[model samples]
Structures are given as C-alpha cells and as structure tokens.
Target: MTIFAPTTDSHEQQAPPAARRRRRRVGVMSIVMLAFVALCGYLVGGFLRFTEEVNLLAKPAAFAAADGIVVLTGGAWRIDHAIDLLKEGRGRRLLISGVNPDTSVDALARLTDTDRKWFDCCVDIDYAAQNTVGNAEIAGRWAREQGFRDLILVTSDYHMPRSLIEFDRVGNIRSVTPYAVRRDDLWRGDEMPSAPGLRVLASEYVKLVAARFLSTVGIVAKQSVSTRVADLAE
Candidate 1:
C-alpha cells in the first residue's frame, strides 16, 4: 500500500546548470550578431552617402580671384591645376603644401610643365605638412604671414570637403573658396562607380570620417609647430 506518488517535478528538478549556461550563451551570441548586423548596415549606408556627395559636387564654372591659393599635394595634375589657377590670377600667391623636402622648385616646374619663373616669383613650398591637417595649418600660416584674408583652396575633387573642414578649424584664414580638380574621365553624371573610382572614393570617405571624429574630440595638430595661434591683425 506504500505506493510512491509519481512526481511531475522530477525532470524539472534534475535540469542541470549546464542547460541554463547554454541558454545564456545563446542569448549573448544573438546580441552580438544583432550588433554586428547593425554596424554593417551603418557602414554601408555611410559609404553610399559618401559616394553620392562626391558625385553631386558642383564644378566651379569660373573661379574668381582671392588673396592666395593653397594647393594640397596629391593626385595627378593637382599642382598643374594650381599653377594654371595662379596664372589665371585666381590668387596672388600659391603655397604648394605637403611638398617633399627634397623636391626642388625647378623639379616642380618641370613636372607641371610650367615656367620656373612662376615658381620663383609666386610659389612658396611647404615641406612641413605631411597630411591634410598639416596642409591646413601650413597654408593658414602662410596666409597669415602674407596678410591674406581670403584663400582659394585647390585639391582633387574628392578631397575638397575634408580640406575645408581642416581649414575652417584653423580659424586664421577668413574665407576659403574651393576649386576642385576633377578629371572628366574619372567620374561622370550619376554614372555607376568604376573599380578605380570606387576605390579612391571609399578611401577618401574613410579618411574624412576619421578627420571628422578627431575634430569632434578636439584633437588637432599643435599650432606651435604648424600654425601660429595669435590672431592675425586685420
């Protein structure tokens, strides 16, 4: 008559901690996967937006003269374009920023196929700048030294945005007019991104994002080494 009552709680009570651990691990993995997917989506969206901005950049129909011109060194024909702008009286002076220390004015003249006379008269070399931030600093200092209030900024098509950001932060130069050098064959009206074009744009976008973040954090090159912090006497 001592029959044991069958208990429904036996299996529940015997469930090991291992089962609970498995559930916890699955939850963590799910969260991680979700976060990863979200990050990918964000990056992809940013890339698309970057490309669209580059494509939509308006080419300057005509460039008006400014106080000076700063040409950032990189890309094919950038310096040549700057030289042409200088000859056209777009600016009174030209600072070829981020130039190699070993590069001579004669070499640059030959490279751009411009007369050495122009380099000797109007061109100033900035061998200190090694990056875009440095470019802004060096150019700003030159502008200040020359008592320039407005400057025409010359760079490749994809680089204008970032360069302007740095220039704006410099707080020395009053105005910066962008004169972007765009190759007709590089990109066209809403055309599909080619391999080379996409690669270049993607690289620039990443750099732009990085520069923006650094600026947000108040991280920038030291003024002492690059630019003078003193207010330019108007």
Candidate 2:
C-alpha cells in the first residue's frame, strides 16, 4: 500500500500563497466598499444640505418676537439676518456668539448697521466660541443668565440642524426658535453651479459629519481652554 504524506515545506508554501491571495482580495474589496459608502454619504448629505425648505425660517413669528435673539456666527447672511430682525424688533436682547475678539464691538455695530448702544446694552459679543459647540455652550449660559425662556436662534439654513443639536445640548431653555437665512442661487451664469460655491457646500458638509461624530462621542461637552478660564473667573 502506497501512502502519501504531506511535507511541512509543501504545506507552508501552499498556505502562504492562499493566505496572500485572500488578503489581497479582502483589501481590494474593503477599498471598494469604503469608496462606495463615502460616495453615498456625500451624495445624500449634499442633497439634504442644498435642498432648502419652505420652513427654513428658523424662528416662528411668535418666537421671533421673543425675549431674546441668539445668533450663532459662521456665514455673513447669519449676521445680516440677525441684524435685520433686531432692527425690525424681533427681540429686545441679542447675543451674537462666536464673535472675533480682534473686531471691536463698535466695528460690528457699524457692519450690522446697528447703534453702539444696542451692542452695549442689548447685544453681547461672545469672543470665546471658536466653533458651533462653543457657540451653544456660551449662548446657553447667556440665555440662562438673562432669564430668557424663549429665544430666536439665527443661523444659516445648512447649519440649522447641527446648530440645534449644540444649542439644545445645554439644558434649561424653554424654546429655541430657528431662523435660517435664505441662500442665493449658488449657480452662476447659464445656471451652472460655481466651483467655489460647491466647494463651500462640500466643506460645510464635511464639518457637519465631523460635528456629528464628535457629538456622538460626547466631545462637544469637553470645555475649551477659554471656557475653563471664563468659568474659573466666575
């Protein structure tokens, strides 16, 4: 009877080849799936980000006429809309969070076409916040201190969803009214969207995704250095 025994060398050589082939296939498949998922995410997010709704108005009429207005800064339209509403008597008090410290309050008033007195008395320039999470925390504190139960939250339409998350994360507020600014047609001549405009939208979408991830992991609650200092001073 002839019996065949498998040698160690044969097993080792065959195993390595099969294992390498499997690894290559897995790596290729993983890359393809990851690309597909990323594409899908971007497409869906872009669609939602660009699609403006009739209800883009952040604040309801009743809320707009509330005790105070909280405008989270990012886009130019956000500040413009807030200033317009304030001029129109949307709210008695306005808190413009995420203001640049280098820019004087007087300069901001001039930019918004509001009086210096408004900035001194009614409006607060929050210089601490560097991002949306900071905006929410700082604004939330201001709202609580002012005893404002109802507030008009002003931000861009694309940002409202994420802004709401940050704003609401800090408790002790009655109502948050969203006032989304209407974006102009991003498309240029011939109705073709401008590359710069699309780039801006894409950048914002990326930020939103990052924000969502940070929020999920509770990173949003991590106080910044400025926030800690401010708290300690208080």
Candidate 3:
C-alpha cells in the first residue's frame, strides 16, 4: 500500500554552482559581443554621414571679409591661402595657429614669402596651439582680446567639420566661416594630389567623433609643450 502511493514535490532541482557560474559568464559574453557589434555599426554609419558632409564642404566659396582669420598648421597651402586672403583684405588680422615649437615667425614669414610689414602689423603667429582644440582655444582668446566677433577658419577640407565643432564649443565668436583647403591644392607640379584612401577618411572620422564626445564629457584635451615665438626677427 505504501509503494502504491506517489507524491510530487513542489521544489525543482537546482543547478550546480559551477553550472550557474558558467551560464552567467556566457550571458555576460553575449551581452559584450552585442555591444561591440552595435558600436561597430554606429561608427560605420557615422563615418558614411561624415564623408557625405565633408563632400559638401570640399570646395571653398567666396566669403565676405571677417574680423580675423585663423589658419591651423600641419599642412601646406593653408598658410599661403590664409595669407592671400589677408592680402585680399578678407580679414583685418591673420593668426597662424599651431606653429612648431622650434619655428620662429621670421622663419614662417620667409617660408610663406610674406611681407615683413604684414607679419608685424596684421599677422600674429600663435605658437601656443598644439592641436586643433588648442587652436580653437588660442584663436578664441586672440579673437576676444582683439574684440573680434567674426573669423575665417582655415584648415584641410576633411578637417573643416571638426574644426568648426571645436570653434562652436568655444562659444565666443559670433560668426565663423570655414575656408577648407582641399587636397588638390597640395600639389605644386604636374603631380596631382592623390585622393586619400578609406583608411585615412575613417581615421579622421573617428577623430571627429572623439573630439565631440570628449567635449560633451567636459574633458578638455591636454597640452604640455607649446611653441612660443619670442623672436620676431629673422
């Protein structure tokens, strides 16, 4: 009679601790994988949008004169173009930002073949800017000090969007017109400026994203050594 009776228990068997831990690890790994995939997709989409936006800004248009002009270093033709704009009376003052620490204004003047009077009177060499963020910060200070509300920003074509972003974050200048220096302008002789590969564009796009995120997080980029031009003489 006792053997005939069968009862069902309410509690189910629990998994072993090792098995539970394994399951948790697997879950965590899956979540991490999903997050990584999402991040990659986000970057890819953002890069495509960045490329499209950059294309629109590839060509420089005829712009009205501003209070000042700021040309970021690290490339050719940028200084030349900014100097030409200065000669054209596009801006009252030209600030050459991000000069090398070893460089002197006299050297820059000679390299650009600019008039000494222009360098002395209208052009200011900013050796303090170490990067693009530094460029914006230094340029903003210069603009504020000079009572300049409008400015012409000169940089590479692919770099224009990020440059504008940094300038806007400064929140000082009333107006900023970008003068994008395309790669085509880099060439001097019959040799042409080859189009940058995808890798280069992707690198720039990532930098643009990083710059935006860093600013949003209220993290100002660091600068240790900055160029100071004490000697105005060649």
lDDT of 3: 0.79
lDDT of candidate 1 over 1-234, digit per residue (tens): 798865756754566879767877999999999999998998889988877766655357665799998899987788988889899888898988887667777888889888888987888888777788888877878888899989988888888878888999878788998887875566744555677788788888888888888889998855423342222111
Instruction: For candidate 2, write residues 1-234 as lDDT tens digits.
Output: 998899976775778777868877999999999999998988786656443331244334544387788888777678878877787898888888877667777788788777777676667778787778888877778878888888888887657777877777778777888887645554355333467656655676667677777778887645531642243001
Report lDDT per candidate: 0.79, 0.71, 0.79
List the candidate 1 regions with Cα displacement exceeding 4 Å: 1-16, 61-63, 188-190, 221-234
RMSD to the hidden true structure, all candidates: 6.1, 5.6, 5.4
Q: Write the per-residue lDDT of candidate 3 for residues 1-234, one digit (tens) a residue.
A: 456433332111266678778877999999999999999999889987886666667666777999999999987689999999999999999998888777877788899898778888888877777788888888888898889999999988778888998898777899999998777533333232235535556778888999899878988778722545432121
Q: Distance from true position, residue 93, model 1, in Å?
A: 0.8
TM-score, candidate number 1: 0.80
* Candidate 2 TM-score, true structure as reference: 0.71
lDDT of 2: 0.71
TM-score of each: 0.80, 0.71, 0.80
Off by over 4 Å in 3: 1-23, 185-196, 224-234
